[model samples]
Target: MPTATPSPDFVAALREYQPLVRRVCRLYCQDADDRQDLFQEIVLQLWRAWPRYVPQPDAKLSTWLYRIALNVAISNLRQRTRRPARVGLDDDAARSLAQPTESSAYEPEEMAALYAAINRLSDVDKAFVLLYLEDRPYDEMADILGITQNNVRVKMHRVQERLRRLLVPASTH
Candidate 1:
């Protein structure tokens, strides 16, 4: 069957929110290749869903995008973990990994530490972190996450505390 061409509106939305998708991928995937693959998967999923996406005035486009991206990332992670883990990468791959995927929000060292801590989090908590980092409003986060606003607030607090403990050294605590 012939594929439907993407609508101009879908193209526009993807262009505008491409960074958001990258951010989601960065938060979820540690490997450079995995990040890129996840990004492509996200874009494909977004394109496939675009026709059914009716923008509700109350729910922003980014929220819907987040919902799809996070679901894909979490599902992908689950599938990946079921397989045997890969060993160390080649020198070139390591060098590529050493480079920042995107302009980081924190300093290099701080970003490294923060990402390390975040890596330890559950996928759901990582979603919370992504939304928090994006400066999304709680209502929007809840909407994107398909949870109650109060659940979002509570989970966010717990996730923050978890991240804080993860970041703090035992000697300093």
Candidate 2:
């Protein structure tokens, strides 16, 4: 059996926006192996779907990528028999996260705690978090998520509130 070679165009595009894909994997898979598996799955799905992709002025590449990545991650989560507890960031996952343009916003411990809390969120909420963290604008997020910009804003607020509650120590609550 032989495998079809991926086109140069697909390769180049994926290489460019891989961090977006990695962000999705990091949010969904805590284990290194699981992350790797999910990444491969996403690439495979993207490649298979490549020919069907019709680039349009209104449809940003990132938006299409997010839809696929989030769908794969959510579907992968559903197929998991055991959802791994996210205690800390794996080194690779940490390295792959989209960094702040300026100084680091959170301390290392704070970031780890934040990720753990994010892991506790439902799959849909997790999608919201991933997009928000990627610094995606509300309009782009709405397009990616197939919702109105207003809905994206509302969901983002609720997701943020959930994270705040999750981060608070039980004793503090």
Candidate 3:
């Protein structure tokens, strides 16, 4: 099938915001293959939805970009059954992650533990965690989830508590 060439504006918008989509994909899909598939799906959905994108006078483009990317990443359910039984971390990737780079915030083992807990969260909770981790404003988080701002604040607090519970050692709790 011949692929429709993206409009110049579409091309520019996509190129400028791909990293945002990639980050969402990485958060949602642990397997590299699933990550690439989700990335492609997000791009396809964005391309299909481009005609409706009205550039408001004062709105930030990244906000709209995040909305669409999160929508796609959160809604996709077809690949759940196809997920591999075990996803192995590449040795080189693990080695690089362990190395203390200039910007390293946590040890790789801590990061791995964090990811393990995150993976165990429910899908909705995972969405909440993603937004919280990104430090999205309450209003924006509410808009993304179609909830009130107060509700978002409440839910955000609950989500954090849940994550804390998950991360706390069983013996300490």
Model 3 alpha-carbon miss at residue 73, Å: 1.7
- Judged by TM-score relative to the true structure, which candidate is superior, 1 or 2? 1
- Could you estimate the TM-score for every candidate? 0.87, 0.86, 0.82
Clashes of each: 0, 0, 0
Candidate 1, residues 43-138, lDDT tens digits: the string is 999888887888797888889999999999999989889998653344454444345547655555565667777878999999999999899999
Q: Which stretches of candidate 1 lie over 4 Å from their true place?
A: 86-106
Those runs of model 3 whose alpha carbons end farther than 4 Å from true positions after fitting are 1-3, 78-102
| Global fold similarity of model 1 (TM-score) | 0.87
Judging by lDDT, tell me the better candidate of 1 and 3. 1
Which 10 consecutive positions of candidate 1 have the poorest summed lDDT?
Answer: 88-97
- C-alpha lDDT of residue 56 in model 3: 80
Between which residue pairs do clashes occur in model 1?
A: none
lDDT of 3 by residue, 9-120 (tens): 9889888888778778877777678789999988888888888888886566767777788788777643564664544445543443345557779887777667667766
